[model samples]
Target: SKLWGACRNPWDTDRTPGGSSGGSGAAVAAGIVPMAGANDGGGSIRIPAAYNGLFGLKPSRGRISSGPSVGEAWTGASIDHVVTRTVRDSAAMLDVLAGPAVGDPFTIAPPAAPYAKLMQRAPRSLKIGVFTSSPYETEVARECVDAVEETARTLENLGHRVEYARPEFDGMALARCYLGLYFGEVSTLMDRAKTEFGARDDDFELDTRLIGMLGRTMPLPDYVRRRQQWNDFARALGAFFEGYDMYLCPTAGQLPAKIGELDTPSHLQMAARLMLLLKAGKLVHRSGQVDQMAMESLARTPFTQLANLTGTPAMSVPLAWTAAGLPVGVQFGAPHGDEGTLLQLAAQLEEANPWFGRYELLEAMI
Candidate 1:
């Protein structure tokens, strides 16, 4: 919070640009700079890209080394990339930053040619699956769903085969597994806070404190089981991709969140709310109300996690706008080593429907 103090959406200052990388999102959207650094451990990159009307891609795991200082992040669930206004910018940056550092644990093969140059022409006809369902069965906003449908039409017009399909998995179980890993990371940060900053419960957000408590008390075997679930989910998606080059979905289940709508409560305030739930016997993790709240919070982002879990390459392309004049993006995910396909498609889409014109309008308004 101290870093930027609630970075707001340029389109509407009363709305958020989206998370962890929201600062980058806001800067790019407002034309403060052409591109900015971003990273995605979950939907950190794509979420912001969707909210701010930019292009953001998460490359295959190990495509960009996270070495010298650290080998992997979030147990390899995270990767570094950038949010960009142009697909070519992202591709050029990838060409610059991608490679294995000495003694790195693993590495992905380098691109056949510089990505910036590769975008010079359209890609060959490919098979694309149009998937719109939220894994959590949460209600996706109409605008978000419409964005996927519109993108599918545009891709088909670009000579790619499009079909309706989705990977099979238990949404609730995957959420549990992901939350377990996330909580473990939070617990680690808590340790750092105590040691370095002398921080305590009062210093954390309500959600962070509660999640940390759960992580501290969680059994070791349970954590292991959650990781195992990650492997299982990855395998399932791998098989599902056998007949398709990529799966297209909404970047978010909803539009950008209004300011203060998704704000984090201070620990003390949250503790009071927790007591009320506890009194009603609804504080347990398995409680229906608790589960509903968790789902709701994640509802806008249920589609982005599968790619992160599988270490696949995925991208958010700014392809549509809502009646309220907000941007909503479509996400395209390819198999673990097929980032080139996503880049090529994004370039083609850029040519078909340029967004710089919209960026110019935003500049005039601001």
Candidate 2:
């Protein structure tokens, strides 16, 4: 374990920065990079980006290449993207990374123009929908809600029509269905690992081991049923988006947890804690479910998971800061393959708000 030294939290050495992308978030937030690479199966990019005050975009499922390694990550749900400080920077990164590689299962069509170039243009006035609560009935933190409201104001000021609305779908049912698909992938991956390396539970972290165990118990029929649920959820979102160009919400139910709050030697314990936090957030409408002692150890990343499930394009823009001086980001999503509109609007907001980028953080770090 000491081979990599302790994965110290850049914010506070006593804690961890969250994983499996913790290092990327910590490094970016600490001013090591203006943007860093991140992948999200379940909120890896957005969570770290939110924690580090960077912009994170998990584009539509096939938008970016996952090739030169595997055809899909986490059963085609995961994607590669970048976390950055400015919205334009993320858009630019997408231009660089958005495309399927050789042997890809499916490819997302390229944009009409380079996304980076598109940002220099103007975005037309568009309708924006805002929701503060999680689709699964999760309570969002006041800070998160405040950030979304502020973003709404920003959007309105920039000439977009904004309205308060909630999707008609049930978030809890969708979450359960999504979880089944996610766990099924976990099981598949574990089986492959076991076959390849003769590895067992001891080879992975507590959470990974638990995933493996759960994968073993999932029947094929359960997997099929879950896929159907995913389809239903996606169709609901498709209909919801037809009425609006974009949906705005908090990237996470709450702010970043302190580091080291979710660390555990037992994978099952960690997995249980994660599920508990998700369920608690859904039930309570906020993210204080994890013990205060462990909140810093575990990362909270529920709000970003929806985009992953639906294969939609989502971005987290850091536009506000908490009283405690932590950055708060508002997330927005567009329909699959419709990143043009999202980037256009992001560029408009960047021009209006002009969030400090590398220079500001560099000055602070110095």
- Point out where model 1 deviates above 4 Å: 2-4, 264-290
Question: Tens digits of per-residue lDDT for model 2 on 1-366?
Answer: 323755654544555555467788778777787788888877788776666667777788888878878887776678888777777778878887888788898887788899888878898888988988766554568999998999999889888999997556656555655566665777677788889989775676556554444555556685677666767767878888889888998887776664444445467476566754454323322343222312222224556667777788888777777786667778888899988888788778777777675337534754
Model 1, span 212-312: residue lDDT tens: 76666556887898888898888888888888888999989888888777665577466646753454322344444445555866887898888888889
CA lDDT, every model vs. true structure: 0.84, 0.71
Question: What is the alpha-carbon lDDT of model 1 when measured against the actual structure?
Answer: 0.84
Pairs with backbone N, CA or C atoms under 3 Å apart (clashes), candidate 1 = none
**Cα RMSD (Å) between model 2 and the true structure?**
5.9
* TM-score, structure 1 vs. true: 0.93
Q: 141, model 1: CA deviation in Å?
A: 0.6
Q: What is the lDDT of residue 239 in candidate 1?
A: 81
TM-score of each: 0.93, 0.84
